[model samples]
Structure formats: structure tokens, C-alpha cells
Target: MHHATPLINTIVGGLVLAFLLGILANRFRISPLVGYLVAGVLVGPHTPGFVADTSLAPELAELGVILLMFGVGLHFSLKDLMAVKSIAIPGAIAQIAVATLLGITFSTVMHWTLVNGLVFGLCLSTASTVVLLRALEERQLIDSRRGQIAIGWLIVEDLVMVLTLVLLPAYGKLLGGESETMRQVWLDLALTLGKVAAFITLMIVVGRRVVPWVLAKSASTGSRELFTLSVLAMALGIAFGAVELFGVSFALGAFFAGVVLNESELSHRAAHDTLPLRDAFAVLFFVSVGMLFDPLIVIHEPLAVLATLAIILVGKSAAAFALVKLFGHSRRTALTISVSLAQIGEFAFILAGLGISLGMLSPQGQNLVLAGAILSIMVNPLMFALLERYLARHDPGDEETTDRQPGEETQLPLEVCHHALLVGYGRVGSLIGARLAEAGMPMVVIENTRARVDMLRNQGINVVLGNAAKPEILSLARLDCARWLLLTIPNGFEAGEIVALAREKRPDLSIIVRAHYDDEVAYITERGATQVVMGEREIATSMIALLQLDAAKLPY
Candidate 1:
């Protein structure tokens, strides 16, 4: 058989299985990632049919992670991380430390080898951004306060994961060599870290600036194929540079490269553009991880796998929930945020694979980690679905309430409302929607902009495509039952007329009307509005409310 034929067959088989399983996953309300991992396990070499040649799988897996980190780096600016530095840096370190210590403790009790136990801890320490991000995106909660904080916190974990990869190889190499001493191992470890530090400096000074320019230049050539090729080239180049030049794994280099590019202007473009390739390669990475799982090991060491998963998902979530709540979000917000961060992420695959290569993990230990990864990815979405339902009942407005950033009204409309009725879906309407959403109120948003309506719809928000000042629009919004009506349009005369008309019709409609300036307030008031809320006055009132609220009692 031609070498290319087996590779092609393997990829084709895996993809087909993945597609089928993904369909099932979606239909069943489960994450498609679960299906992808299962597909990998089914088609892997350890199984019978369509066994993928995994020798190249790990290398390809490296590209997948690189693309992922590249997207992360391009978007995750140090400034953003620094903005949340108080939480991200400390939260990431603390979580990893706690998880690792627990893993080590469990391993000691189970009598696993010290090296293998360390590998176990390393594998279990980090959360999977891919799993969590996908789940949040699926639910349209990606821009929420909790989601933003979770992403920032994940970056911190990525930093630690990268450092661990750089340090582990040297430690593991000692076990494979003849008559190695602990002192030499420590020295190699020091030198390995030093090399990584130097490599990071070189990348920052050189690769970060150069790579984006290379990508931009390629993009300017007006060739999609060329642009795709360029992304891979940069990712591979950095990965190769780290491994061949610095003795660090390609994943480590890829990560630092991403961190550097995170500071660039092209981060969002890079993320949006390279998604297909990242997803394609990312699929292969998970499949490769699934292939690493051994059923026999689970039969023999089921206790270990369960123990590890329990500590990682549940124990870790508890810690994160407490940490986030302490940081000032509501318990509901903290719960959702913590649940989102509960699973071990795709990057764990990278760390574990490197550990396997470096002899830090025994064959069984590797299998255990692989199984844990599969299970975690599988349950992440379900866990989120459960959590969402739980929060809806217990904390209905958590995501929307925590979400505050606004933009030109988008087509996606998943905005939650509270005691407010939004009239007009213009910039102000959408901005107010975002704010009211963060406050956890059920709001009925009325808008007439088709493009904006479409954008709000896409965002999974509650919206009516009509003028709220109209009687029919007000009726559609169920204004008779509404506690507050927010009017945000430029037609003061039209609004005044509508307000007069509404007062005549309903007589008890409590409406908050926005005016351009103070002089318009009297006319608005004369029209029978309960209150006139100028944008300026509203801001002041909100600030006062914020000031009055107990910061210590803030729900994250």
C-alpha cells in the first residue's frame, strides 16, 4: 500500500465517523466534541477498523494546538490578561496547585510510582478552553462576565501548562538514560527552563512581530490558499523552532508564539480566519488523544480514573466557584463560571502527550489521562446544559445579567430581559439591552432595524422587530404587564405623541423615556411618562446604585 493511502484512509475514516457522531451529539443536545473523541477511540490503532497511523498524529496534533494557541495569542492580549490579573494569575496558579496536590495525594494513597503520580497531577491540573469555550459559544454566553473571566483565567493555566512542558522533558529524560542522578536531572531542568526563557525572548523580539507581518502580507496577496498556508507555516515554524532549537516541545513554542501575537492588532482576524484549519486539526488532536485511551487499563484501574476525574471536575469547580464568588459576582454567576471551567481542556492533551514522550508517564498512566480527557470533554456540554437549566431556575439572569459590553446592534438576539420593555432596536436600545441583561431582568426589546434585528436574533436575544411607541408594538411587548418601558429613539415629538396616546389607552403604563437634553424632559413629562431618564442622568443613577450596593455581597 502507498504510504499516503493509509494516511488518507485514516483521516477520511476518522472524519466520517466524527461527522456522524457529531450529528448525533447535536440532536441529543450533547457537545460534538464528545462524539469526536469517541470516533477517535473507535478508529484508533488499538481498535480494529481504519486504525490511524498515530506516529504522525502527535505531530499533526501539535499543529492543532498551535493554531488554537495562535488564535488565543492573537486575541488574548497581555493587556486583557493584566486587566484581570488579580483573578487570572492568582486563580490559575492556585487551582493548578490545589488540583496537583490532590492528584499527588491520591496517587500516594493508591501506591502509584512517584514519577507517574507527578505525570498524573500534571495531566489533571489544567482546564480545557476548547471544551468550555465551545459550550459557552453554543449557549451564546461567550461574552458574559463569567465567560470573559473564565477565558482570562484559562490563559493563566495555559502559561503554567507551557512552563510544565518545558520543565518535564528534562526530568523524564533522566529515567530513560543510564545511571542518571537527581542532581543532573535538576540541572537539566534548570537548563531546559533557561532555554525556554531565552526562546521566549527571541520570539517576542523577533517571531511575534515578524509572524503577523508575514501573515498580513500573505493575506494581502488575495489568495485564501496562500493565507492558510502562511498560518500553518508560522505555527509550524514556531513549534519547530522551540523543539529543534530550544529542546522545548512544539506546543510550548506554539503557545508562546500565540501569547506574543495576542498583543497584535490582527488577533481577531487571525481567529476568525483560521477557524476552519484550527477546527480541522483540532479534531485530529482529540482523535489522537482518544486513540491513546486503553479500555483494559480502565477495567483494571477504574478507581484511579474515577478518583482523578472527581478531583478534577468537581473539586476544581468548587474551588473556582468559591474563588469567583469571592471576587464579587453573584453565587449564580460564580456557579455558571465555575461549571464552565470545570473540565480539563484540549491543551491537556498537549501536556500529557509531551509527558508520555518524556517518560514521565507510564503506559497505564498515559491511558488513564487519555480516558479522563475523553470523559471530561464528553460531559462538559451536558454539565453545562444541566448547569444552565439549574441557573435558569435558581438564577435566571446570571449570564445576561453579567453581560455588559454593547456594540452596534448585532443580528443575534439571545438577550434576556427583566422588568424593562425596550422601544427601538437601535444602538441605544441594544446597549440598554446589554445592560439590562447583565442585571438579570427579563426585557422585551422592540427594534425596527432589519440588520440590527438579525444580529440580535443571532445573539439569542428576545426581540420584537417593530416600533415600541406604536400601540400594536406596545401590545406585542405585553406592556400592560411590564414594570418599566424604556423609550430610546430620536423622535421626541413622535415619542411624546405616543406617550400621550399610550396614557390615554392604558392610563397606568409606567414608561421611562430618553431625551437628548434637559429641555426635552418637560415635554416628555407632559406626555404622561412616569419618568424621563436622560442617558447622562441614567449613568449617574446607576453609579449611585453601584456605590450603594455592598461590594462584599456582589454576585460574580
Candidate 2:
């Protein structure tokens, strides 16, 4: 029995195309988002191929946006933002204003209305969180002073976008209204602000207390599936309820739900559990944006497309550079900040989608936004690569600069010397770290998880906050004076990379790595790992020794 399943077909088609193109993009060293967007373009109504059900894509895309926002809220760290507030806050605002002005100017030249121009400008003003973070991570700069500033700047942009999402509809109505009085506009604006404030306050005071408790109880059941279900329910339920009761957007509701849940210790687990779903939905979100994009716009309106790209890549970059430099930061810092934010991504799509739904922005405007996004994302990695090469030639002392604050380094004490490098802080690494502590060995730990990093810091354990695969992160451990490089992380392929780097740095350094399988053991060993501890082999050996001891006791 065959079924005419529009939803199933849309999902299957989207995922299959996304995976194929995503792999291709990754192979070419481009962002996977580009591939997902391209996949949408191929399968869209505008293209000559199997078209996904257009009616179903947008609704799925909305779910994707909600999950993306929830993930953002889950990872939000106020402390990180506060560290770079001096530059990040003012810098982000000024850059947005500049980008918006450029967008509005282009719109004026194209004969669009001011309201449409405003919506278009706002969409162009923000950069992709995913792209910026991935770039920083690749270079091992996520914990550096420049990285912190970039992240804080992004947080400001996100908060601004959230507020923009809430006020845009009301603003649209106010602008479009012919019969509305000044008093009525004021009343409507005040009412909207009041409702937003009420939602935030309620989430902070009540939802924080209740949401975490519910999650904790779910987690206590020892059922991973149950905990995962609880998280989804909270995210989707709160989003739906916020629309019904507080009259806010789903994005805002999901964002608040995540923020409330973040207060829980199990928040990390919740985030880890929901990551696959969030990523799937996020991919759908990009695909939906691409589906709306008309490729012939580039052919028909080449000048408009170029202008939009200029606003994003050139205008926005120039504005950010000027702001960062004006704040008395180093030129390197300014360049990094500017180039890192030269592309627009998910938020742009979300804002444009909202504008379309409100009848504020034309389809032409949405098409332009999508075109700009695809082009900017495709070019951003090249920009980063050039920036790195340029910086390398101009400035050799990138890390030892005067701009780095004391806290920018890991919580390791300055006096600690000749410490071993311990990568990972999970179940296996934790046990290993405990043993190392008992042996009175001073060591530095490399970890990626926020929760684990916090716990390690609380215990006065020195830790670097990034993946060990990045050479810059490994360098932070002072490998020159280190006695041992312990790759306790579970992934053997990643461990192989670390081992290779360590061996190249210091041939005499003791290197140890963990493996789960025989193939992993062989791979790590081939990569110059001095020791490979296979868990299954060790378990069998221990069991045999215990059996021998039992047999000896019986004979005696």
C-alpha cells in the first residue's frame, strides 16, 4: 500500500539532499549550511527537480528555528558577555546601525518603501552564530581575549534580534495604519512591551523554579529517552503557550524556556540529548530559506544582489573594524572582529520569514536576503584564511600580545610549571584525573564541555576550554615543559591527531591514548602514541587475574 505522504516525502527529500550536499561542502572546506541551502534550491519550486512539498517545509522550518533558539539559550553565558562588554556592547550596536543604514540606502535607491527597507536592513545587520563559532573553534581562539569579544558581540546581536522580532509586527501595524490615532499606537506599543516584560519576569521567577525541577525528576528516572522527551515538551510546549498566553513569538518562548532550563545542573545533559534534533531542525530552517530564494534574482537583479552582498561583507565589516579600532583595541583584534562577522545566517532568515508573514517585506526582499546569505557564507572561510595568513606575516606574537587579560588564560596558576597535559574530563578522564591527583602530579586538563570545565575549575584543576585537535589549544598546555600528554578522550581518531602533534613537538614526551576497539588501538599506535589502553583488553586481563586469585585460594 503506497501512501501520498507529503510530510514524509518533504523530510526524507530534505535530509537526503542535505546529507549528500553537506558532505560535499565539508569536503570542500565550506560551511555545511551552504550545502543545505543549495539542497533546498535544487529541490525548490524554482528549480528543475523533485520538489519537496512547499506547504510543509515552512512549518518544519519554524520548528527548526525554535530548536535553534532553544540551543542558543541553553548555551548562553552571561559571564562571558560581561567580560567584553566594554567593546562588545557598543561595538555590536554601532555596527548594526551602520549595516542597516547601508541596507536602507540601497532600498531607497531601488524605490522600496521605508518600512520594507527597515526590515531588510535589520536582516542584513546580524551575522551567523554558527559560522563565527566554528571559525573561532577551528583556530583554537574560543577562550582567547579576541574570541571572548567576538562572542560577546554576537550575544548582543542575538539579544537585539530577539527584541526586534517582538517589536517588528507592532511597528509594522503602526506604520501601515491609516485610521489609528497616536494614543492608540502608544497604547499598543506599551501593551506589547508590558506583555514581553511579564513573560520574561514569569520565566525568571516561576519557570526557572518549576522547569528545572521537572527536568531533574525526569532525569532521576534513569531513562535517557524520558529525559529527552521532557526537554522537547518544555521547548515546544512553552513556545506554543507563549503564543497563546503572552502573545509573543515562538522563538522568544523557546529561548526563555531554554534560559529557564539552563539554571538546572542537568541543563548540559538536556542540551546534549536534544542536540541531534536541534541540528536536524536547524538544517530544515536553512533549507526552507533556500526554498524561498529565487536564483534568477541574481540574473535579473544582479546590481541589487551585489548591493545586498556589499552591505553584508563590506559595509558591515568596515563598520565593525572602525568600532573595534575606535575602542583602542589592537588592529589584529579589530580585523578579526570585523571579518568574523562578515556573513549573515539563520537569524536573517528568521527575521525575513517574519517580515513575509507580517506582509511587511516583499518576496523580492526575502530573495535578496537569501542570496546575500549564500554568497557571504561561501566567501567567509576564504576571508578567515586570508586574515590568518596576513596576520601571521604581520604579527608573529599573536598570543603573547599585551591585549590578553589574565583571565583569558585558563584558571591555571601562573606559577604552575612542568605540568602534564590531560585531555578530556568525562567518566574515564575523571577517574584518571583522580588517580593523577593522588600521585601529587600537577597537570592541566583540556575539555570542551562547559559543565565539566566549570566543575574542574571549582576543584582548582587547571583546564583549557576547547578541543585538543586544535594545535593552538594544545600549545596552551605548555607542551614543551610537560612530562606527559594523556589523551583520555574517547574518540581515537581525534586522539591520533593530538598524538601526532605532540610527537612532532617533542619526540621524547610520554604520550598515552585510550581506544575502544582494535582498529582504534592500531590507528593511535600508528600515529606515534607511546601507549594505547584498550578498555576491553584491560577488562579481560583484570577478570582473568581475579579468577586466578580465586582458584589459588580454593586450592590453599
Candidate 3:
């Protein structure tokens, strides 16, 4: 008997291989993304063994794209984009043009048609939102000025891609010798644009009111499961509705759904709740992209792959760097933005897929884009590391001298000293913070979540929006001057690192950490935590005290 169906085998195999390779990559201090893509290649049809269900992967990948775009929409900020418009808009446009031209040149050299070249160029123009965000967040730069500009630039790229996705089918028809006449082509274009406009208008006007109302009602029910289900329903429902009614893509619909829901007070909760599912599906998406990449391309078309890499890593970076510098930013800022944008990921896959579907891009073109994406992602972290080392060696005070621009609030006061430093602002951390605030103690919080950072600031607390594990972020929290360091985040291994770093930085600081298990207590304590607080022990002690008090009151 067959032990597993295609769907089951694909998911289990894809996830299992991705997990193993992803761990291996992380162990080697490489991005898990490289491992995920490589996992796809290993299980791909082009591979020798354990080929996954080819038909099932793309369907799963579509869900990933929808959720990923929805997440983008949930976090999209019009105000933030407006703030960086001066540089982000022009820089992104110019950079896209430069990259597209380079891609066209490569396509021409490969003997592809102008239309194919155009589609390939367009695919190369956009950067991967997933990879870019992860890179920025890992380094604790998402709230920094450079991060803002990079994010804003990505938003513009996304908007352009959305438009391209909408118009591409019609444009492809026009170019594919399918349109009856130029008039018909223009008419088709008008209809597509009209439908997109109507969808956006309805979403902004109706969805803005209805989505929030629905979410508020779901919240009022006080059922976490119901709220989560409601958020998913909205995302999927809107996306389905858009395709059914407006001829918009699932990604575009999901993006608009997220943008509309982003206006709700519950947006952060929506994002938090959907994150796990989003990440899982996103992994599948990357794996699917990998499955499409034939490794033979590297051997069969080495120069094509080389040209693609040159365009992605060199040409694109150069364009972004020049544009940012031209916009009057510092060299450091230019480098930061350039390095951040030096890779492509999800959008490239989506655009390449669309181009293939339209019969404009050959399978070879898609493979080249995939190959380029993998190489660029692998090199991105190194690029950032090099930039950091360069800055440290040549301009030791560059990061310190870069002042916070207007509307940026992650900056901590240089004078803050002898205060308690709290990492994370989740449930346990919030309780501890409230107590500290009520006791009139000075405290600083280091959090990576933007929403939580806003909440903390609104309560008149000083906060740094970044991961505490990074030395730069730790520096921003004034760890050297901190009297106490509290680890309220639940991850034991991560807490150990933070404790070890804190102890190394300031040996006199009193460090308190919370853990869930016995081994975690030992692990954290050994790593220099002055006190390791265990939940089970604390609960047991409290219960024992209550029982004893009751017995004494009963005159036993």
C-alpha cells in the first residue's frame, strides 16, 4: 500500500528536509533561507531522490504568497512612507530602472526577445520584502533611519509590482500577437485598471469600516481562537473576492485586506496571531521556489547565471548606492540602504511565475532569477558584516554620530544611568514593568516589536526598539550604566546569550532571568544570571504559603 498521498508527502518531506538543512545552515552561521532553498533543490524533481509532488507545491506556495503579502499590508504605514518619500521614491525608481536595464542587457545577450527581456528586467527590479525585513530586524536596524528608508523604498517597489501584476496579462497579450488590435489592447488595459481602482476604492471605503468592526466584535467575544479565525477569514476572503470580482491577484487582494485591517486598533494583535501560520507557509513558498530551480543551470548556463548575479548583487547595489548618495544622505546611509537592497526573494518568484504563465519568460529565465536570488541572499549577510567592519575601522563614531531623524523614537537618552534594563514587553515583562513603574523606578525597555515600543513610549517609558542580543542594541539601552538586567523573554537559549553578554559588559550588574525548566535554570545561571527564577518553583512556594496561612487561621 502507498503510505502517503502526494499532498502529505510533499508537505512532510518539504518541511522535514527544510528543517534539517535550515538547522545545518544556522549552525554554520549562515542564513536559514539558504538552507530552505537548497532543501527544495534536494527534493526537487530535477534531483535524484525523494522528489516532492510537483503539482501540489505551487498551490501551497500561493497560500504563502497571500499570507506574506497580507503581513506586509498589516505592517504598511502610509505616514512612514510619506516621511521617507524624499529619498525612497526617487531612489527606488532610479534603482529599478538601472537594474531593469542591466537585466535587459543580460537577456539580450542570451538571445531572448525584447518582450521576454522586458519581463525578466521587471522581475529583477523588485527586492524581496521577506529577506530584506529579516535582515533589518536581525541587526536591530528596522527602527533605524536607514531601515526606514529601505522599508519605504520596498513599499514603492511593492506598489509598482502590484500595478505590473495587474497590467501584465493584458500587456503580454498585446505583445504575444493575441490582441486583435491596438484598440483592443488599450481597452483591456483600461478595464484591468478600472477593476483595480474599484477594488482599492471599495476596500478603503467599505473594508476600512467593516473589517475593523468585525475585528472589534471578535475581540469583544474574548475568544482567542475566534479572533484568530476571524483574521484569517478576512485575509482569505478578501483575496478570493478580489480575484473573483475584480480580476486582481491573490497577493494584491491580501495586501489590500491587510492595509485595510491595519487601520484597526487590533492590527498588532492580528499580525501577532497570524505570524506562525504566515512563517510556515512562507517557508513552503521558498521551498517551492527552490523546487523550480534546476541546479543544472549553473553548469549548463554558467554565464547566464553569472550575468544574473552581477545584475542582482553588483548592478542593483551600485544603482541604489548612487541614488541614495545623490539624494544627499551620508556614505554610511547609502551603504546601508544599498547592502539591504542587494538581494531579491519572494517578488522575483511571483513575477517570474507570472511571466512564465504569460509565455513571455522561458523556463531558463526563471531558473536564472532563482539562481540569482539564492546567491544574493547567501551573500547579503556578509555584505552587511563587511559594511559594519568597514564603518568600525574607518569611522568608529559613525553610528553614534547619526542622529535620529524626525518621527523616529527609538533613541534613548545618553544620560540614562543606573536604571533597570528590561528585554521584551510581552505578558511577563509587562507585569514586571508595571510594578517597576508603580514603584517609581527608572527602567528602560529593549523590544523588537514596533507596536509594543509605541505602547511603552505612550506610557512615558524609555524604550529601544531592537533585539537585546545585538551589541549595538544593547549599547542603545545604556547597558554599561544599567544597575539591573531583567530577562523576561521566554527563550532560554537566547536569554543565556543575553546574560553572558551583559555579564561580560558589566560584571557588577545584577542580572535576573526567568526560565521554564530545571535545565534552563542551570543554563542561565551558568551564563552569569545573578538569579534564575523558575515558574514552577515560584508557583509551588506561593501555593504552600497560602495553604499554611489557611491552616493557621483555622486554629489547627
Q: What is the C-alpha lDDT of each candidate?
A: 0.70, 0.81, 0.82
Model 2, which residues run further than 4 Å from truth? 1-4, 26-32, 61-76, 133-144, 178-220, 227-275, 353-359, 399-419, 447-473, 490-494, 514-526, 533-556
TM-scores, all models, native as reference: 0.65, 0.82, 0.82
Please name the candidate that would achieve the greatest lDDT relative to the true structure: 3
| Residue 63, candidate 3: alpha-carbon lDDT | 82
Q: Write the per-residue lDDT of candidate 3 for residues 1-556, one digit (tens) a residue.
A: 1788899999999999999999999999877887888898899999898999877887887787778778767766445546799888888888988888887888788889887888898888888776787677567576566777988898678767776776788787667678457776677667877888899899988998899899989989999999999999999999899889987878778888987876565776788688788888878876887887778888998888888888988899999999988877778888889899888877788889899998989988888888888778778878888988997787565353463454455464456888999997777888999999999888999976566677778988889866788777888889989989999877787799999998998999999998988999999999999999999999999998887766456854
Q: Give one digit per residue, the lDDT tens place, for model 2 in 166-187.
A: 6776677667775656676577
Model 3 alpha-carbon miss at residue 206, Å: 6.7
Tens-digit lDDT track for model 1 on 1-556?
3556766866777778888988898798677787888888888777786688777666666667777766655544444445566777787788788888777787788788788777788778787755665665556444344555777787668667766776576566566675667887677667766887788789878877788788779878989788777776777788788878887655556667776665444444456568788788787777776777666666887888898778778888888877776766577767776787777755566776776777666666666677777777777777887886887687765233343224322223333323587776555676889888898888877764444555777987667654444455566666667777778775566578768867877677787787867777889899899988777787888999888988789899
Error of 2 at 467 (Å): 5.0
Off by over 4 Å in 3: 26-29, 65-78, 176-279, 381-385, 395-400, 403-417, 424-430, 447-460, 463-467, 470-477, 489-496, 514-523, 533-544, 549-556
